[model samples]
Target chain A: MAARILIAEDEPYIVESLRFLLGREGHSVESVNDGAAVQARLETYKPDLLILDIMLPEMTGFEVLRRVRESEITKALPVLVLSAKGQESDQQRMADLAANDFVMKPFSNRDLINRVTALLPAKTLAGSGQAPAAVEAPMSSDRE
Target chain B: MAEISTGQRIRELRQHRGIAQSLLAEQVDISPSYLNLIEKDKRKIGGALLHRLAQRLEVSPAQLSGVEDASLVRDLVDIARVLSFDGLDEAIAGRLVAQAPDWGQAMVTLFQRYKDASETATALSDRLSQDPQLRELSHAVLTQISSIRSFAEILKDVPDLPQDERAHFSGIIASQADRLGLSAREMIALLEGNPGDEIERSQAASAVHEVEDLVNAQRNHLPHFETAADDLRRRILAAHGEGSITAAMLAHLETKHDVEVRQVEGDAFEGLVEEGVHLVDLAAPRTATRFDIARRLMAMELREEIEELARNDRLSGEDARQVARRAFANYAAGALLFPYVPFLEAAEHYRYDMDRLAQRFDGSFEQIAHRLTTLRRPGAEGIPFAYLRSDPAGNISKPYSLPGLRMPRLGGACPLWAVYAAFAEPHKTVAQFAAMPTGERFLFVARRVAKGAQAAGAAPAAYSIMLACEASYANRLVYGDPFTGGREATVTPVGFTCRTCSRQNCGQRAQAGILQRA
Candidate 1:
């Protein structure tokens, strides 16, 4: 069974890449650019898993998680948080909010796919054995 | 249910391992009574004793600390599962633990308890549907139980737990539960009922097991998750459209990388400006920022070195002042090559490796730190990288950047910054965490390399240079291996801020300055 995945990230490139990756893995993917749209999207789209980023425009990813956990309708929905802020405190806070999983930024496409596959409903994760995911070369940038 | 104290755990572990108290004491080289006191929770275990206990128990010192337990293990697994995308390894985790043990343990415990409680609550809620109040009470009780356990462990050293303190702890726990919408009375009642509730108990057991799985996943996954996240953030920033990255963006990246950047501003030079040599006055017109003037002045000093090399004669007093002016011009040129803002961005992007930054801008290491300081261009300034140069005997020769640090007006340098240690290490990089007398801690990396030397028989025969910046800014420099342990050994206590420093024992006091400086 294909898992319905929702991506809440402000970065277009990241969202696009993640969409392409999960789509290839045969999971249904929906995305929003900010935290404000999460509840509305959940109301209609009903994603089985959510991939969220910390630094969003209006409500933060943390705030979104709080609201999701608070509402009876979406309280049990599995959430996977994504963040550029990788402090120990940040990871702990995400866990405190009951996020199903977390992945840091600058992720490998294969690993991202693997983590998503593993965290999805067990029926969706069935075929993926615990073998090492394939590595992808990082894109070059002039900033560094 | 009764909870085991640290003392009880120690006694149990000792008994289970079949080791007698006296023998264990001998292994740790401590008196048996001292070991007894620790096991009884009569005394707190210090770092050395904790290390010995870990060695004996075949566990990490963190495990011996009694702050975290089985639930902590589960949280670690959960975090690792989320972070597995980054390709982080055990080595990185080891380094993180070594650098900050207490924080690591706290995180592990908090995550584990959260997962366990949530799962237990869910199952109990389903089982006690006929008794909503009991269901709510059960959840609250479990939450409070975990909170009280953790709090007791943290405050075990407080000997006597007063009623008010216990109430305060319970209040905090209740508030947290209320915020989470969990009810206490309901949870306790669910636990109080008949033996048939065992089915629900099994469900709760499964929740605990699931939490353990999550913890294991986190322990294995977090490093990779963090690394991947960092890589993604960098990619996002690199492809950032329209505008240059802002300070907030940089701060975001810094937080992601778990590194800090320290910025140092140039100090006020009292006598030099008034001496009528007019170096400050001449440079003021050409420069817009204080850092620009400071760099120009430093460059002028270097130019005098070049002139003395060419002239092959000692500069007369008037001629030396003239050389200072020329050195200022050299500084202006260096500043032009590596302007503050863009350079700092580049520095962060490259992890502050000097050679890499030098190649990027075609500038030198000294020039990079020097230009980095000048990044104090009002609104768009960079991190303050205080620049200091000292001779073999620890005499302060140049205090170009972070004048507020008050780098000795004459002879005030701390031995702990690795600035002096650089002499022994030569080209090798030495990094240290230094605490000033006033308890302001700074990370510093330093090296010893000579600038243009005086001729064979000048008034100053040998001049070696020592370069250092605050450790916070060292992420941009390539000199030291920062990830290694022994941070405690490397921490040297120092004080140079005249107004703020409180080294009452020092004989080289020019004047006492401010409190809480740095």
Candidate 2:
């Protein structure tokens, strides 16, 4: 499956990693640095999955998510809250704001890809996973 | 944090694992030249190629990208802020992060202990230097000892040592010993650091925190004070006040409330005392006199309510209670001078032009700026602003702030903040769009408020006041009118303070962030 993803983050280095990982995974990706810009572009990009960081300029990721949940169009948009603030309270706030997933900072690339892959709709999976999926599918069936 | 070159990281990882370059390169399916290029930072590697190398090297991609060991950089930054590392500057710290991360962590740990020890010593010394007469007595004893030494030298040089002269010298030596031993009992008590200023500093710090909590809990508004100020204004207007606050309002207080306002210089009398009212330096410029008058009025008229608020708030210490009382009086003064509802309306209408608003209200720029922070009235709310005041000497006087915004607590704020710069241009305001280290942008503005008049003998007290809000709120502010929505062009970067701020590129940073270690 292939999906258009938008990463709302400020750190250039982290942005590069996400871009490379998602691009290699065959997902179309775009990014915005500031919090307000995230909301502005969410509708315009209409990304299937939104990866957002909490600490952003102009506004915060929480503020962006609040707007996303309130808007008619972006209400059901699959949003993942990424933050350096990894406390339970922070996660709860993100969950309360209706984020689909939460990713902690200094995240493992493998863990991040897996989470992103899981969050996106199955129909959006890239063709590269098809052969592996087919093999795994038969194996699971045989076990059953 | 400065990034460690990919080559250096690879080399460190390889050496640590005892793997040869050619063996590693062949295993990763890269030419030895390519490996060398990556090692020397002559080649940029990312995505597939970087991951391929990471797999063969048995390291995470984050290790290659300077992400996994980023905390080491942060630790180095922190250590640098606290203590000096002559051989380990930022670049060297980055190298250490890539090559020897455990060493960096050790440095951070050691520095933390060292800093704690230093602060304890400072506090001890501060507490010991308290007694006055002890210093005078110590100096007298030292002088007496020096005189005795001189007399002994003269007696040694004299060829005809007379018996009477020897007796005289002996008598002087005896007196010297007597003087030295006389203050010996008193000197024992002066053997420790002075805690006087330390206690006062702690009290001031705690008091500010207490008030901040109170302000934050109330959503930055005081409705009762607002209502009371409004009532006072209506009463004054009903009385047909005709002049500045000192003339009309003071007269009204004197005639109606039987409260006389008197100016007394060289005295600590502020707010109100038993003799009706006694204010120190009543003729100061801008709104100091007006504020003094307003504070006195609030102290007299609303003493019961202020006391009740303080009592109910449950502040334990006398210092905190005194600070809270003064805070309430000042709040009432600001509210009385600039009534909330109209001020908010004017703020909105003028886009929060502090000077214009100050002129309109007959107050100082600092007054209007401070008053702006208090407009948290629920239905008629003003812009959420973080206000701060720092004197020319870099001492922060007012540090009222919200959650995202923190006023610098240790080693002063970043020198880059407009508030510090305002001292260079007295009575002038500087407007800017600043970004915090966290990438949160602010509509920052600062102005130097010169108190007192231009008299030959009077040296006016001068300090700078600064106010800021989130950049998105800039459209609602005239200060940010020029920059508008985009802040890229005029973004002056700053951080909270040296020890804690994580900004890597800030030139004014005295110390590194906690994560940036040696």
Note the clash tally of each candidate: 67, 30
Worst 10 residues of 1 chain B by lDDT: B215-224
Error of 2 at B349 (Å): 1.6
lDDT of 2 by residue, B1-518 (tens): 44666788789888998999999889888898988988999998876677777777776565576654554565565455443323345666677666667656544433333333234323443333354444333333333433343343333334375889666765664565455444432443455456465446534554564554444444456678889888987787667654454565687678767877666553345434686555546455647778888887877778987887677443545766778788888999898888887888888888888888988888888788989999876456788888888888887766766546756433478788899888888757888888877788887899887766555677878888999888889888878877875747777877767665676776787766664653
Q: lDDT values of the candidates?
A: 0.52, 0.67
lDDT of 1 by residue, B359-421 (tens): 776554556555555554323545555566667776654454332233432234555446777
TM-score of each: 0.27, 0.49
Candidate 2 residue runs with Cα over 4 Å from true position: A1-144, B1-205, B240-248, B264-274, B280-282, B312-314, B452-455, B485-487
Q: Candidate 2 versus the native: TM-score?
A: 0.49
Question: Which consecutive 10 residues in model 2 chain B have the weakest lDDT in total?
Answer: B113-122
Off by over 4 Å in 1: A1-144, B1-324, B339-342, B401-404, B453-490, B495-518
Compute DockQ for each candidate against the true complex: 0.01, 0.00
TM-score of structure candidate 1: 0.27
Top candidate on lDDT is 2
Chain A only: TM-score of every candidate?
0.82, 0.83
